[model samples]
Target: MISFSQVTKRYPGAGGGYEALKSATLDIQPGEMVFITGHSGAGKSTLLKLMAAIERPTSGTVLVNHQNVSTLRASALPFVRRNFGLMFQDHKLLYDRSVYQNVVLPLNIIGYNAAEAGKRVRAALDKVGLLAKEKAMPVTLSGGEQQRLAIARAIVHRPSILLADEPTANLDAAYALELGELLRSFNQVGVTVVIATHDEQLQSRLQPRCIALAQGRVTQ
Candidate 1:
């Protein structure tokens, strides 16, 4: 679960600062699929970053999975982050690595044994419809397939919460729909999915619980 109480994030500037999120507050229940919509610079990415602890808030509290992210120590941050699976707008795949290796990166970082990690990697790839492409290079796959591979990497760690930021940014309409459906499938199985995107058609079609932002504040 995610909760924000008057949370604000500011980046220091030459003059003073710029507030990316201004006292925004909201709650996302466990197992809920939520969409975050806003125009450029509306703070959608900042909101997700706060939830993931990639950026600390300047004021108020950010709570995820019962831990106060605003106060989480660096030593314990990785433990907290393990509960989350984040999908970036850029797929961030290494071209030299195979799909299986890409999916196993997270597990490898956490010291998971090869045998166990392999099974989990296969299962995650299967879930994202990329099991057959395990040996394929990321550069060789289609845009949609690359995104699906990213999703697999995120979930291979078996995260409880999935955060996707502008996931459909450069994809075609049909691929965008396919990606949305793929994310929903994970939600159906109890993974809390929070997607930040500006795709109105995708939003209008699925119409999941949405949080709209304007100038860094929740306007929904």
Candidate 2:
């Protein structure tokens, strides 16, 4: 579970600073599928970063599974982040690596043995319907396939929470819907899914608990 209390995130600049989130208070319970919907620069991505401890709140608090991430030491960030799987707006895939290699990277970082890493990589690819593409280069895949590959990479480590930013961006309607269903399936099995997107169609179809933002404020 995660909680944000009066959380504000500011980036310093010449003209005072820019606030990405203003007193944003919300809670995401364990195993819940939640959508953060807002226009560009509405702080959806910032909220996700705060939850994952990639960004600390400029003010207030962020609690992930009861740990105060806002004040956690730099050395402790990796440990906290291990519990999260992140999918960026960009695919962020290594174009030179095979799909299997891409998904296996996280496991490699954590020092998982080859046998275990291989098993997890295959299972994750299968879950995202990309098992057959394991040996394929990222550039060879279609847009939807690339997205699926990203999802596979994110979930390969079996993270407790999946934070996806604009997961359905740029795909066609059919592919977007398919991706939505794929993410929902993960939530069905109890992975906490948090998606930050402006794709209202996908949001409407899935009907997850939506937290809408406007001008960096949690309006709903």
Candidate 3:
């Protein structure tokens, strides 16, 4: 479902530039669950960004579902991004919005009808075990609940692929394990799942294909 061919990403700097990702190449097939694990500044997030087109490859190509995202025009990014859901470390939830309101943002962005949006929002929350908390404020939820809410928001659009960066960073071990299981449950139904994290315990539980990184390069 995804392939990277000798891709590199460099950032501009006063001295010249800093390479955030070095000639990294890998493949992630449809319906497969995987983990990208490495230390801080290891380019794990850059790898995900390259796949999502948030950052263009400095060289080579990145293909998602046979689409060469590396060469797509600016206006074409949203179309490609719709195929994947992103759950970042921050969750990015709106503190002012209710749980239900947060999950429905994606649908609203794509112009889904209000009637349909209502159903999807509830369904997504139910999936994340937050059905009863629909009208509750995001600030009232615990750390694990907030992460699950983010997951619901990400998947609310029914995206074919899910990308999460450090999803378990703040949670305790038990909650992290639960989050891993929840992610795998989505994969069980055929959604491609890829997560970047430093959580070895969580990775061990899922036993998914792991791609390790070091200093912006793929080490395994």
Candidate 4:
């Protein structure tokens, strides 16, 4: 569902420019689960961001579901993001909002009715096994619960693909394993999953199709 063709991303630096990705070409098919693993500054996160259009490449093309996102107009970005779910390292939940409300945010953004939003929110929470904590605020939850809430929020919209960057970064190993299992379950149900991380324990455990990177280049 996604393809990167000779993509390169460079950022302006004091001396000249820094390249985060160099001539990277890869493809991810629907229902496929994959891992993008590398050390810090190795371009794993850059690849994820590029796929989500959070960052555009300096050169080459990024195509999502056959649409060349690099060429899409600004107004069309919403439509593009609507096709995929994204989970970030920090969870990024609103501390002020209740878990239910946080999960319902995206549905509200797309104008789903209150009744429909509740249905999706509850379903997503159920998927993460957090249905009972729906009314609790994010700050009140434990780290694992908060991360699960974040997963619920991401999948509440039922996007065809899910892109996660360092999803278990700050969590304990147990929580990390829980989250990894949850993601694998999502992929089993046909949601394309791509995760970028430096965690070797996670890498060894899940064993998904791993694309390794080094110094901004794909090494495997």
**Tens digit of per-residue lDDT, candidate 2, span 122-178:** 999989989998999999999889999999999999999999999988899999999
TM-score of each: 0.96, 0.97, 0.97, 0.96
Alpha-carbon runs more than 4 Å astray in model 4: none
Candidate 3 C-alpha lDDT tens digits along 45-135: 9999998878889898999899998878889988889898899889999999999999999999899999999999999999999999999
In candidate 1, position 70 carries an lDDT of 82
Against the true structure, whose lDDT is highest? Answer: 2
The local distance difference test score of each candidate is: 0.92, 0.93, 0.93, 0.91
lDDT of 1 by residue, 106-133 (tens): 9998999999999999999998899999
Worst 10 residues of 4 by lDDT: 77-86
| lDDT head-to-head 1 vs 4, winner | 1
Between candidates 3 and 4, the one scoring higher on lDDT is 3
> Which structure is stronger by lDDT: 1 or 3?
3
Candidate ranking (lDDT, best to worst): 2, 3, 1, 4
